[model samples]
Target chain A: MKKRLFTPGPTPVPEEVMLRMAAPIIHHRNPEFMEILARVHENLRYLFQTTQPVVALSCSGTGGMEAAVSSLFGEGDKVITVNAGKFGERWTELVQLYTGSSTEETLPWGSAITPERLKQLLKEHPDAKGICLTHSETSTGTASDIKTLSAVIREHSEALVLVDGITAIGAHEFHFDDWGIDICITGSQKGLMMPPGLALVAISERAQERINEPARKPSNYYLSLKKALESHAGDDTPFTPAVSLVIGLDEALTMIRSEGIEHVWKRHESLAAACRAGCIALGMKIFSSSPSFAVTPVWLPEGADWTEFNDALKHDNGITVAAGQDAFKGKIFRISHLGYYDELDMLTVIGAIERAMKAIGLPLTPGTGVTAVQKAFLGK
Target chain B: MKKRLFTPGPTPVPEEVMLRMAAPIIHHRNPEFMEILARVHENLRYLFQTTQPVVALSCSGTGGMEAAVSSLFGEGDKVITVNAGKFGERWTELVQLYTGSSTEETLPWGSAITPERLKQLLKEHPDAKGICLTHSETSTGTASDIKTLSAVIREHSEALVLVDGITAIGAHEFHFDDWGIDICITGSQKGLMMPPGLALVAISERAQERINEPARKPSNYYLSLKKALESHAGDDTPFTPAVSLVIGLDEALTMIRSEGIEHVWKRHESLAAACRAGCIALGMKIFSSSPSFAVTPVWLPEGADWTEFNDALKHDNGITVAAGQDAFKGKIFRISHLGYYDELDMLTVIGAIERAMKAIGLPLTPGTGVTAVQKAFLGK
Candidate 1:
């Protein structure tokens, strides 16, 4: 049975993108690959909505996070990460491992961090060198106001605003330049709608200048941004790239560009809205008060075994969704509407949930979820 | 033009393997992906010649190197690394980054670290937790004697032997169990005949025990071997894997197994013999006195401009071989015979080199290189 992906990432890949990935392998140093490499850079710049050069790496989004910490700040330098969810907490971990230990402003689980809090914290800290935040917290399905948060960081003058935009870039509206973001990182598997193994780092000129400054700690050999940039300027990576995945991403980015940026965001917005409405009509509550357009976390109704519900949906209906992480595990589930998704797919997910709930003796009409989703789609 | 790749890595991927990689995307956590992941683990065991579970990561071979350092040794722990070539030097860098420091027994460039030297070092530094060496140093084309080096470490009974087999495993003979190699790390792009995404680590139970001992330093979020093994038991990865590349490696391993492990090593041995004979017949000197069977690094004859030779080969004959790295730059070039290459490919590479050299006024007899390679292949 062919299953549909409604998980936050490693999302459904377009056939065109898949074929592009399956294309013949080429030498990364060859002129042919150089052309593809240059194209990937250009496409990433367009997706980031910035003129800053985007560096492509053959590691996961975590590697991009590591790069941000290892390159921008030296050992023992003070930094702050907005810990709103699992990813935000990971920012603190990466900072501890790569740069110096970090200070974290953590929100309660299933909550979003506010720009006002960040403004107050940074002003108090005064000497912090960088501020890190997750633009879309996939773990909790909460989206932060990165644009406003970055503005606050810019006002602080000493700190650079770095964003982990792994699940936000294509599905949400992020103008890297307009937001005054210094370092924006994303992965190919998430909103980019490609396979895993490529991490993109879009570094502003200001960030680049900071990275070039001498730091106390020794830089990582593979994650050295300066070396990567020097090699990238000649249309080559500092290391062997995931060549096929780069091809996949180039093709996927072209599709996103063709769909138009605003339209892409609107597509995610409508899908998320419909899915959330369907869940509410099924007598469920949304997990986060303020949710992201990428995914909607929903609380399972009382006495509903989320593990059993997830298994039934996967085994019976061939529908794969995301279960909750950390303490929320087995209490909440997530429905993703980002990356190669449509209204029809959203409806299919709703239909599966409806079937699973009715089979488990939960109260539901035959097409109650479907009717609510349709109404939401039509703005009725 | 179709280009032939003889680089140390990002080697020529076989068409069948490419097709496997091009397979329709599957959910990594689904049954389909579980089956594929299981096959990857099983076949990797066969390739590593060990029964211990192997872990695959969606990172470069360098990541595997880092995993070896960060997992077994904590920060401030003493370790030993052999610096014979670029890859060995990389091990030094990783140790410094993850473990905070290590002692390196420097071997002169283009020279192998003799077993006696390793024994001497271990005896001098009994406090060392592990010993690191590259089985095949791609930069210098030097092959270390893993059997003798492991014997030296096993004599100590305390220090584990870590071998960086990134370019050696399938092409060269390695017995992880028989040779007592505690940690053998490799990449899919080398002798595996696949794209660059997956890094394979085969660790002995003894190495796992070392990791189990609590250290003061915390484990890395991405390179956490403990977390990875917990997920591996269920045939799943903790993070999003490079799914298509895993499929390609599975298929490539199947081919290798079907061919028989001994026969694969025999093929590489014969191909390497032919390559060396061809180079010598063309009056080029071998770079490493004890050459690695995976790649042959050869010094250009006097006054031969390496840049012109490589460019003509790539542009005129559509042959892309590897240039030397670091201090060896322009002084030598490498010809890899690791994956997806046979006598015919070797003949083509040697023939192209002869033509390129002749066109650039380097001395070479007509049909000299070809006849030598043919004779070696024919065992005449």
Candidate 2:
């Protein structure tokens, strides 16, 4: 069976990007690889919507977060982390692990961190060295208002605003420089439409200044941002990077550039809307009050077993959707509308979900969800 | 013009492997990905010739080397590093950076560290916590006698024998368990016939025990061997891995398994022999006294400019080979018959080199090298 992937990350890779990565492996120190790296560096800056050089690391998204935490700040530094979902919790954990002094602004899952709340926190902790945020929280399908939060931080305090835009950058609208973001981190697996391996971080000049401060001490050796920036000037990495993945990312970024970032974001928005309409037509509730265009979190109909529901989608229908994590497990399922997805993919997943729901004895008319998706696509 | 790659690392990837990697990306946490991981785990064990679990990492081979150094030993622990070439020098640097107490057994370039030399080192510094060796020095085209060195280390001291088999593992004969090697590291780009993103390390039970000791303090976060082992038991990585490269590696390993490990080694042996025969017929000197079956480093003929020689091959003949590093730069060139290469590739490269030599005004019979390679293939 040709299984379809609808997960938020490790999304379906484009054929062109995959074939580009597979062509041949080139030595990192060679002229050919440097050419590729130069193109990748430019495209990453374009995708990040920043003028700063983006440093690529050969690890997961968490590695990028760690690099930001371990390199940019010092021990006993007070960083404020906004915790709304799993990734936000990761920021809290990293800040605690590296700095040992962090104030977490906890919020309910599926809720966005309001600018007012951030302003209050900044007023409460004027000594905070940095502010950590998850731009698009994959766990709860919620996208925070980073631009507004950044403004509030700028007005309220002098702390740097760091963001995890792993699922946001290419799918949603991001204005890094204009929004005053200091450090923005992302992964290759999400909006880039590539496999999981490479993590990219764009650092503002302010963050670079912080890193270059003579008084700052870094805890990491391999993931030093200072070293990465030094090597990036020559279109290289401090450590041996994931060469093939970077090639794939170059292709992905080229595709995104050609498609126009605004159109890509609109496509995701339409797809998410269609998915939400389809779920509603099937009598399922949207799990998040504020949903992201990257993925739609849908509550299973009351009393529906998520295991049987997901198994039916996979085993019987050749479709795979992500089950909820942590506290939401067995209560919700997530359908991704991010990278390499189109209107047809949305229709297919909706049809499969309708069938799965019916098979699991939920009250749903055949073709109802599909009809809703079609209507949504038609802008009705 | 389509270029032919002949570098030692980042060798040509098989078309089948490339196509496999080009397949739609799958989520890392999926059951299907777990199945692929299980198969890869088994194949890696078979390739490493060990009963131990081989951990897969998402960085270059140097990352694997760093992981071994940062995890296995602590500060002020003395270690002995055998330095014969660029890669060996890397071990010395890593030991100095991590342990700060390394005695470098510096041998002349293109030479192997003999068991007797190692015995002398061990006798002089019996408190050495580890012995680092490069099985195949890619820069010098030399393969050290790891089996003999391992036996000597076993008889002499309690130090762990860690090997950098990046260029030797799949191309040469490596017996992890039989040779009593504690840790053997290799990259995906060389013998695996895949792109350069993944690194594999086989750890002996003794090494695992050392890593798992309660008193062991690892300096790394992302490349933690203890975390890797715990995750490997569940067919997972502590961090998200390079999924597409692993998929490509699975195909490459399947091809290796079908050819049989012994046959793969013999093929490399024959290919290397043919390359050396061709170079000799062209009046070129083989650089290493004890050459590896992975790459053949050839010294440029006296008074011949290597830039003109290599440029003619690349620009005119569309062939790319590696030039030597550091002191040997512009003095020697390397041709690899390591992975996804056959007798036909050897013949083609020899023919091109002959043309390149003639074009660069070096003394060479037109078809002498090609005839020599053909004769070697025929076992004449």
Candidate 3:
């Protein structure tokens, strides 16, 4: 079977990057390896659209989130966390775990937090130390307006703005310095088009000041952002890093740079638009009102079992799409058009979904979805 | 240039494992991925030589060491850490960071700690909560007698025995259950013949009890062993794991199982013996008196610059060997006989080293090292 990955993360890694990583591993401390790290550092800054130092740690995306919470704020420091999806809930959880005093501004899943609400929250919580936001919520396939939200926080509050750009940075246009974001975190498996195990965090000088505050004490030893920045300045890591993954990331980033970030974002946008058009033509409702360009979520048709639909797509068509998480499970299915995806790949996924839906006895016009996807790709 | 990796940790990944990892990425929560994890769990227990559950974390080997310390003990608890090399020093550092009180037993870089010394330390620190040992110190190519040391700790004290078997478990013979080791940690890149991302830690029932103790308050949020174990029960990880690395590891473990553990150890032993014989034939002294089968450290000749030798080997021959770390740097170079390495590979490395030595004006008979390696392989 020809298996295809259409998940939000662990997207299809480019063959060039895979082959680059498959080469013989190099010692991390060697000058050769350090040269690779130096290239990766420069490319990471370019990808993040920031002049600040971006450090890579050998852990998952959640590790980066934890590092932000542990390093920037001390005990009793109140943080305002937005909870709009599974990842947003993680921010709330991390803040509660690390700070013990955080205000969770909750919103229903699949809905974006408005800048006005953020302004109101900031007005209410004047002592808030930071505001955690999700640039693109992977679980719900919705992207919050980071630029607007960060602008609101910058205008209204002294709190540092932290954005989880796990699935957003490469797929969308994210200007860290322009938006005045203090911290931006991403994972290697998502927009970077590589395997997991690396959390790349871009920290601004404002965040560094908080980390270097003499009065602030952090409990974390491994994921210390201060130490990570210190070592990264020397093109090294505090510990033995995931050397092969970094090599893979360097290749992936180089590919992205060659393709141009704007082109990458435009490709994602077009692919996502085609997917949404296909879903609408099939008479299925898009799950998120403000869907992200990284992934497209659609509610299953009436009397459709999401489990059976996704399983048929996997077993019969050799396609793997993600089922909705938490309360949304069994009700929605998501198709990712993030990395290494094109209009042709999107058409293939839509064809598979159409076949699976018909196999599940869902009423759908034959060739409707594929035709719509082709029309969208043709800009009809 | 045809490159070769002969470092200890980032040892050569087998071609099959590399190709497997190079395949399209899969979602971590997908059924296909869970199936891979289930198979990895069974094979990890086999490789660790234990019936206990082995959980995989998406971090380096050092993360596993930190988890063992943070999860099992609280502040002010005393741990006896052995510092014989760079990795052993990490244990002392972690213990002091997590637990305020710890006894560090320092030894010469290449020398192994004796059972009598451990017994005396245990007697002196009667309230010690744990004993940390390095099964194979990669920096010096020294393999400590873990079985004898664990037995001594078991007989003389109630401290939990923790072994950093990063370069030991698959390359050498280690019986976790038989040796009564409480916690054993290994990395993906060393004996596992994979890239550096995943950390495999085998935990015993004793350690689980200590983790579950109500009085235990772990400060770490990401690398929590107790939470990791809970998720592993369902064949999952607490965070997004290194999915491609896990796939690579699955293939590597399958290869190990097919070869049989005993045969694997024998191969490493023979390869290391061949390397040692080759070095001796070239009039070079082995650096570690208690050298590990995973790697062979050789002292550079008097007045010879190790940097120039290694650089020539890398540039001219496309071979990558490790220079000694810290105090041993420039004094010695290491040749790894670990995973994905055989007698032929050892001969090739020895030939390259001889050529580089001759290029550096060192006196050596032509083909002396290669002939010695061939003779050692023939048991002559």
Maximum-lDDT candidate: 3
Greater-DockQ candidate between 1 and 2: 2
Of the candidates shown, which would achieve the greatest TM-score relative to the real structure?
Answer: 3
Instruction: Give the C-alpha miss distance for residue B267 in model 2, angstroms.
Output: 2.2
Identify the candidate with maximal DockQ. 3
CA-lDDT, candidates in order: 0.85, 0.89, 0.90
Candidate 3, position A90, lDDT: 89
Q: Write model 3 residue lDDT over B5-117, tens digit each, in one string.
A: 88887888888998898887788888789999999999999999999999999888988888888888877889999999999998988888788767999999889999888
Candidate 1 per-residue lDDT over residues A1-380, each given as its tens digit: 87778888778888898777776677777777788889888888899999988999888898778877777776777889889789999899888775657898889877877777887898789999888889889999988888877887898757888999999988888999888999889988888888788889989888888877765354565666777777767767877788788878889989988998889989998898899999999889999978899999999967799877887788888889998999999999999988898888878999999988877777778898998988987766
Fnat per model, in the order shown: 0.54, 0.71, 0.79
> What's candidate 3's i-RMS value?
1.4
Q: Candidate 3 chain A: minimum summed lDDT over ten consecutive residues — where?
A: A214-223
Q: Over the stretch A1-380, how does candidate 2's per-residue lDDT look in tens digits?
A: 87899999888988888778876666777788889899999988988888998999888888789889888876689999999999999898888877766799888989998888788888889999999999899999999888888999988899999999999988788988999999999999999888988989999999999999998755666667888899999999876677788888889999999998889889998999999999898888998888999999989877789888988899999898888989999988899988999999999999999888888888877989999999998866
TM-score of each: 0.93, 0.94, 0.96
lDDT (Cα) of model 2: 0.89
Clashing pairs in 3: none
TM-score of 3: 0.96
Per-model DockQ: 0.53, 0.55, 0.68
2 or 3, greater by TM-score: 3
> What is the C-alpha lDDT profile of model 3 across A1-380, one tens digit per residue?
99898988888899899889888677887888999999999999999999999999999999999999999987698999999899999898888877776799889988999988888898899888899999999999999989888988999989999999999989888998999999999999899999888999999999999998888755777888988988998999998899889999999999999999999999998899999999999889999989999999889867888778877899999998888899998998889988888789988999998899889999978899999999998866
